[model samples]
Target: LAKTTQPISMDSYEGQEVNITCSHNNIATNDYITWYQQFPSQGPRFIIQGYKTKVTNEVASLFIPADRKSSTLSLPRVSLSDTAVYYCLVGERGQGGYNKLIFGAGTRLAVHP
Candidate 1:
């Protein structure tokens, strides 16, 4: 199984674009990489999921390499309100939904003035 690692904290000014990268060196072949963004008091929102190549939606974009060992999340024109924790989870989507999900310390993103 692949383990993910990301920045413990990051700071950015409002209106700046931010990119966070996660490394999963041992990612499995059937695993799906998912990215979630969490607010201070709210549950995480699904930002994007990708197996390979790139996936883009209204919230963010996920870029996965062919090796499937890492991914990047791009947040465009972020604001102070966007400050939150970002998690990169790599697991079996179908089997893990019913099981308890493990979380990392999480990357705390702080948007500044």
Candidate 2:
């Protein structure tokens, strides 16, 4: 599993674009990058996933460099409701052919009025 590091917290005003970056120094070739968002008292919700290059959906966009050692989650025009902890994860196969995703402490985004 690759170790990921992200900012502990970030501040954004409403209607502003916010970007959170994560670094994984030991990423592997077969690993897929995934991002999740979790609100208070709720489970983490899938935001985006990518292998390389950029991927975008209605909710957010994910960018992965060619080296696969880093990724960024970009949220456009965030609102106060979008405030949450964003997780960056890497998926790999564990022992016994089981797939596993490892998560670290996520970056907390505070969307202000």
Candidate 3:
């Protein structure tokens, strides 16, 4: 598993774009970058996942460079409700084997009024 590095916390105002970057220098070739968002008292939910290049969905966009060593999760026009802890995870899906995703300390995002 690749270790992730992210900020301990971030501050943002409502209606602003928030981008969080995670680094994984020892990322494996079979590994994929996945982001999850967790609200208070709730479990983490999948935001986006990408192997290389870019991936977009209704909630967020994931950007991965050619090297696949790092990735960025982009949130557009965030609101106060978007305030949560974001996690960057690197792992491969199991193929007839038990595959587990390891989560590092997540980045806490604070959305202000």
Best by lDDT: 3
Q: Per-residue alpha-carbon lDDT of model 2 for 32-84, expressed as tens digits?
A: 88899999999999999898999999999999988888999999999999999
Off by over 4 Å in 2: 93-97
lDDT tens digits by residue: candidate 3, 1-113: 88989888999999999999999999999988989999999999988999999999999999999998889999999999999999999999778996688888899999999
Per-residue CA lDDT of candidate 1, range 37-96, in tens?
A: 899889988788899999999988899988988899999998988899999988877774
In Å, residue 2's CA in model 1 sits off its true spot by 2.0
In terms of TM-score, which candidate is stronger, 2 or 3? Answer: 3
What TM-score does each of the candidates earn?
A: 0.91, 0.93, 0.96
Candidate 2 backbone clash number: 0
Residue 104's C-alpha lDDT in candidate 3?
84
lDDT of 1 at 46: 77
Clash counts for all predictions: 0, 0, 0
